[model samples]
Target: MRIAVFTTCLADALYPAVARATVTLLERLGHQAVVPADQTCCGQMHLNTGYWARGLPVVRHHVETFEAALDSCDAVVAPSGSCVGSVRHQHAMVAARYDDDALAERATAVAGRTYELSELLVDVLGVTDVGAWFGHPVTYYPTCHSLRMLRVGDKPVRLLRAVQDIDLIELPGADSCCGFGGTFALKNEATSSAMLTDKVAAVTSTGAQVCSAGDSSCLMHIGGGLSRLRTGIGTLHLAQILASTREHPCPVPEPRRPARRRPSLPGAAR
Candidate 1:
């Protein structure tokens, strides 16, 4: 099958290896995966922040960019549930506001074709393992959108269970939010930090070497807290784990900076 990979903005800038792993997994399955360089942010941040007017053109650009590829590809797959949710749920609202019926229709059509990574792997591709092998134990955090909004449950866990030498641990409160709701982190700074504190605690409590999820944004928030505390808990995306094999091991990223300070509690700064 032919597929187009939409590496979300955070994945592109902060977790490029996640994108590389996505491509690796797709090719390992013997499918054609194209990385469209013209692909940009899905305008989710602007739309979610209520900057509707600013998000219009960005939405249009995405619809146009993916429309061409969707016409010929089997599916448009992304590593982010939030981005997939934006394309599925928000694009039409932006189009309808401007009375761009054609664009709205196009947006809907493309949204229907878009799939989150887990969705594509389990539902469309119909395989769990892709023959990956990771020696370390991994604990997965189901990002809020993928777990609640997208309802992508267990697909990731199922894949993880199938990997060789991957001691998968059930994260305590694995379904809880990681507190990185785009602008929510900035707008309600206190609340966001509070939620991240709990998330990091849960991840550390697992004693798992790595904490992974479908969304890079949430991982960044969770990872930032873990790093600040010098907790030694590493963060990775789901794609990176699925892309790992004995020959091609996924390395834990080097921390960019020490956490500014320790988190005292959920939403509390120490």
Candidate 2:
């Protein structure tokens, strides 16, 4: 299958490894991964922040970029479920909001073919085991958009379980939000931190060496919290884990940052 890789903004700028892994895993499955050079952000940030008029051009550009590329590619795939969620759910809505029925129609066509990493892997590729081997205890956290919005239930787990020699530990409260709703962390720091605290505690309790999730954004938030609390847990994207193989294993991650005291809970012993 010929697939276009939609390297979302966060994956493009902050977590390029996740993007690379997405391509690697696909190619290993014998799929051609084409990354269109002109492709840019899907205007998720603008639409997500309620900037409809401002988001239109960005959405239009994405629709134009991928709709054209889709001419040669069988499907579009991204590592981040958040971005895919935006592509699948927001692009058309934003276009329709501005009364651009034509753009909305185009956006829907592009989105109809776009899939998140797990969605592409399990649903489209029609395979769970992609010949991966990772001999470590890892827990998978299902990102919110992928879980609630995309409803990509058990696909990620099914893939991880197929990894050779993997100890797939179950994450407590795995479906809870990591509180990194893009700008939500910055806008609501206290609430976000509290939610992250809960998530970090749950991850640490899993006794897994690494915390893995489908979205890098959530992993960043969870990783930061785990680092501060010195849980010694490293965060890895799902693609990275799936990309790992016995002969060419994933690189050893850098040591986690030093620990800090956990935030004091109300009426709780510190």
lDDT of each: 0.89, 0.91
Best by lDDT: 2
Q: Give TM-scores for every candidate, taking all chains together and pairing residue i with residue i.
A: 0.92, 0.94
Candidate 2 Cα lDDT to native? 0.91
Worst 10 residues of 2 by lDDT: 252-261
- C-alpha root-mean-square deviation, each candidate: 5.9, 5.1
TM for candidate 2 is 0.94
Please list the residue runs of candidate 2 whose C-alpha ends up more than 4 Å from where it truly belongs after superposition: 257-270
Model 1's alpha-carbon lDDT is 0.89
What C-alpha lDDT, on a 0 to 100 scale, does residue 264 get in candidate 1? 75
**Clash count, candidate 2:** 0
